[model samples]
Target chain A: MSEIATPVQPQRAQRYGLRNYLQMYAVAARQAVIEQLQYPAANMMFMVHILIEPVIYLVVWSSVANSQGGAIGGYTAAEFAGYYIIWTLVRQFNLAIGPQGFHWRIKEGRLAAELLRPVHPLLPDLGYYLGYKIPQTIYWLPMGILLWLLFKPEINPVAWQIAAFPVVLMLAFFVRFFFMWLLGLVCFWTERVDALFELYFAAELLFSGRLVPLEVMPVWAQNVANFLPFQWTFYFPIEVLLGRLDLPEFWPGVLAQLAWIAGGYTLVRLIWKLAVKRFTAVGS
Target chain B: MLRPLKLFGLFARISILNEVQYRANFFMQVLQSSLSLGTGLIVLNVVYSYTDNLGGWSQAELLAVYGVFVLMSGLIGSLVLPNMWAFMEDVREGRLDFTLTKPEDSQVLISVRVVAIWRLVDVLLGIVVLGVAIGRMGLEASWWLAFAFAATLIMGMILLYCVLLLASILSFWFVRVWELMEMMQSIFQAGRWPVGIYPDWLRLGLTYLIPVAFAVTVPAEALTGRLTPELLAGTFVFTLVALFVTRRLWMFGLRNYSGASA
Candidate 1:
């Protein structure tokens, strides 16, 4: 039977065209949806865990606002609610599973297979990530509705701002993904990528405006956050969604996001080259 | 008991030898623990910037809470969780049969099977932090408070072990208990703060429903000289109850396993 069976031909080496990428993304998305559906309870619990962070922060800030006579640092209770609710969406969209992927690929010696792929290995990563978000949004939608009911978020964005939001959010995802992917490459050099991941999380907590608003942080921290790309990933889009950033501030934020995406892409490319060299030299 | 202690000592020695093979892991553990400590300190500093007190507790009190939290987590990671995490895998692969056939209490053997060894760094760091926090608060430690703290800490470890054992035993029934464990861990993160900080309903849930309060807050209260007679009594009762319930559950799970196979 083994001798009689003919080996299947390799699939065509398609060029990285827009249509090809879209089909790949669609297939990846379907796979993610199926995998998530297979473990519905686990996915539901994951969604609950995701919502818990935003709820905790919202409660913390709400308490702060209440203590400060229903407003703190120019944010009323309603506005704070809006800020955190939008923050949940932005965070869900921007969070990357890059470190785990990198660690697994490197440890399992599957990075070699990735290097052998005709297309950019990162493309499949991007596709799988984007695909996962489809099911995540399905999970998030009801939670979003629940938050809206409880918090009554006053998220009144202008039509144009609403249109521009997804584009900027996509840019933000790339920024986060590339930076984290670079951090993940550190596993090639050291056995301990966890320390790097921890620092990344710390920076995200402090600078990404997840714990508190950037304006509420100390001015020095705010200034540092302004220079980093972390804020653009979470805080900027959230601000835009909450209509806190007027048109002038909003466009510049988008420009800054674009700049960061370009920079992050360049950095990831350079890191990937170096990481491959180290990986090959070490024969992992 | 003495034999089990000797077995644990042998396990510790083996784990240490295994860890020594990965010399870089020591640095990783140190770096990870330091960063965790730093994050805790930073959060405390940030909260203090807003007010001297958090939820009616002083900054030093909150630090003590974190100290107990870290210490308990280290204990779990060092002994309970490392084994419980593997317990399911052992059950799935029938490797637990080997443990069952051993000339010892299977529960005792299974509970301390895999010591992470490096997690002792967190334990030591937690002790140093707890000491500093106690000194900073200028609280005088009495014999009763020390005794209460020691007892509660031990009970906290036992309670945590029981909870983990119960959670892992569920794996014998359900193959995918990992996500449930993750959810439990996420819920436990809320316990890092004082239960008082949460809304009243949440406080009730943490205290009775999840029992995370007993794991961290009871010991913290002892250290902060805030342990009431009622709270101490409750901790003791809960510890016994949790241990008894988990012991029964483990045997039930084992019987189920055998019944299904037969």
Candidate 2:
């Protein structure tokens, strides 16, 4: 027991100090990447969803466009191809849609162990999520290029468009993770989040331009989508890459995404506090 | 076969009892069913707003297809999927050995152990939608058409069950293939739209490989009277073949499982 010293005080320091906390997350994230790399086949199989979804939508939307005499919402079949291919990239980079270990943590009573740890329970998981994406993004590059070739998306994005992407994409990922994280935390207050999550996903599906481009949506729906955070996750990055956003739209969009991220951080922090008060270790 | 039904009945009763204890889950299931049906309708509405038809399917016709899709999904989710997923779990944890040792037929036992009875909400919603769509479209009703729809629908369900059983049986060798299951689901979801929308290769893959086209779309075709005799006969033959193959694979997996456990 003496040999198994618990480093409680240092953990307290690390928990309070933002720099140390972030640094620890980096280390944990690095470890997660290594662990994920060990199962290359698993990663490859998993990545198929990221690749296939866009292809499916691309095929579906293209058929609709062709049926409509080759254009809808100012996007031709080729442009749709470009949009989905770019959408795939946006999605892969901002893979915040799927439940990321948070559900399992609560369900399995692993959160009790996490709570015992000196660090905030959420950061390590969040770090692991972000870390998992690093290698996933690396693997996605060749796949993205292959899709790029196959679809032959026609947009000639400039260097600035390319450069601005990582910033926007990172914010998208951050906001999405936090948003989903807040949703996942609802498990603490409810017996099940499954149905609630379905409704949440329905909202996301319509607004995120995952099923259809918001531009093609009716004016009223498009206006409503503009105010929602869902569009910032998938549609904004892809649309921006396609040079769809005008100059006035650009700064405001980025500002909105950042504000949402800040909003998510605050909301999650509040939820976590309430959640901890309710959390019980019954199933570990 | 009678014995299998009895065994299934017992398992299903226990599951229904388990589910009914939680009244909230009943309401939740209804909400989720509505949510999914709403998602499909909204997607249909949005696409139809831009185009008159999707792959030669008008909105109401596609809505009919969606109804069958939902109905079939409920059938699978209620009985087949939860059991299969549980079977995979048992395979991973070596609890499957206990299943094999039971006096009852292990295949039947493992396949009917879990039932999400709440999925009836989806089934109810699906039939209502199908009824409304048929009424709205006025697509020439008849008893023979109903018979054809039932036959094709049963064939589709059997084929889906076979495919799911086969996939789950693979867990004997490769335990963590939940990703593959997720992939299958995404592919299965493509069945919502008419297979005609897909390119030739994809259409063939959905037809012959996953059999999703047969599982959902062909039944919809039968209901709409678009299904020909050749298609009907082909689906029947294919279902028989799949059932035979998956049954053999299940036996092989049991052998592997018991051998490893022994």
Candidate 3:
């Protein structure tokens, strides 16, 4: 019974630390990249699906601007083009695991297996969605170039704005990621999530400047956007890259994005504690 | 023709029966449609706030366009799209053998198999919007206008069916056509605005490549009293040609389809 003199006693309680989590994210991200890259055709179609939304907005807004004597709420037709073109890229960045995916995971019993893991389910999702950016950006390049050529969009970013673009873009991803994960957690409570998800997306569509730049919206709507995180995900990044924001405005936007990310992360953590407690695995 | 109609009726009844068992989905569809409609109205209002006209379309005219877009979306969603998806799935999973072996025509069988009955909520909603739009425009409904609207709408549906069927036919040769289907649907979003607003290149693509212009805009134009006789004539010819070409392609694709197994 001498514990058979364990061949090599497991190292004294190796704490699952940050380095371990980082390694886990790297592995998960790499897996996501490899998995997404294999479906070139499928990914291209998805890119087209994503691209059409912004393109419609660009076309419609550009037409409105042109029709309205070259500008509306400070965006010229060319600027609208520029905003939504870069929107294509921002969209690629901020794409996250939607609540529908969570509902699917839960209903399919995949969450049961996932709960067996030591880390939160949200961590791997963050990594996977982060890695999803790789193929998405790669697919975005040709489409971006084609859009640029087609629309002849006029984006004028200065040196610092260009440099700050990537940072804000990544921050935007974090903000959206946590919020989306938080929304996904509601699946733990109710299976009837479609109406809720639709409402969330509709809100995002209006407030996020995914439809049009916030400035172009009515003053009241723009004021409403001020309190919502939706704009940080689309409007802030696109404006930053479109060079519409000054440094002072830029810094505050970035700070607000960080604030949302922190708030979303905290909410997810608190809700997740209750959500996990309510979970009853119906499958092995 | 009568036989196909009977077959379609029988399949539609079965689909309706199957769907009624899930009554909650109807409410969900109603909520989703209303939300989208609300967002669409918001977008229109936002756009109208800045300009009285969008690409030569008055706000009321554009509302009519939006109504047609929703109506056509309901038509496709409730009738055409689900069938195409099922057909593609059957092809991918080799279940299409069951259809081909049936006594009825394969095309008719595939076309009328799945009716998403709840999606008709959008249809009713679209009609309501169209009614409001017509009231806003105060268009005197002439008998000719009514005839033209009905005629163009039927043609539009046929043209869309042909185009979508043409797309689904590719599932025979290509395993992953859902992406293509999704892309087409997104492109259809362009029809929400008058195809007139899009750049020339896109206008041509939407009109010819996808026929969304004929499907949504032309009927909308009819309702708005903007449909020219020549455009209506041209649409009629194009619809005929599309149906013929789609029929031929379906036959060709069926021959090429080896099925998932021998």
The candidate maximizing lDDT is 3
Leading candidate by TM-score:
3
Estimated TM-score for each candidate = 0.91, 0.93, 0.95
Candidate 1 CAPRI category: medium
Model 1 chain B poorest ten-residue lDDT run: B253-262
- Residues A1-284 of candidate 2: C-alpha lDDT, one tens digit per residue: 12332322213534267787889889888997899888776677777756777777888888888887889899888888888888877777676535435677766767667777788766786788778788888778888888777767777577777788788988889879889888888887775777888988898888888766788777877888877889999888888888777768888989999999999999988877777777666642
| Alpha carbon lDDT at A14, candidate 2 | 41
Cα distance off (Å), candidate 1, residue B206: 2.0
lDDT of 3 by residue, B1-262 (tens): 6988888889889988999999998888888889989989999999889888988889998999999999989998999999999999999899998889888778988998888899999999999999999999999979999999999999999999998999888888877789989999999998889988888988899989998999999999899888899999999999889988988898898899886756
lDDT (Cα, tens digit) per residue for candidate 1, span A40-121? 7788878777777776667666666776677777787688889888877887788676687788886766766666666667
Give the backbone clash total of model 2.
0
Error of 1 at B117 (Å): 1.8
Error of 1 at B209 (Å): 3.3
Better of 1 and 3 by DockQ: 3
Docking class of 2: medium
Candidate 3 similarity to native, TM-score: 0.95
lDDT of 1 by residue, B1-262 (tens): 4987888888888988898898888789999999988987876676677666666688889889989888888888888778988888888777777788778888878887789988988999889889988999998868998999999899878887787788889987888888777777777777667777766766787777667788888899888888898888988998889889988998888888752222
lDDT of 2 at B231: 83
Candidate 3 lDDT over A165-202, as tens digits, reads: 99999999999999999999999899888888999999
**Which consecutive 10 residues in model 1 chain A have the weakest lDDT in total?**
A1-10
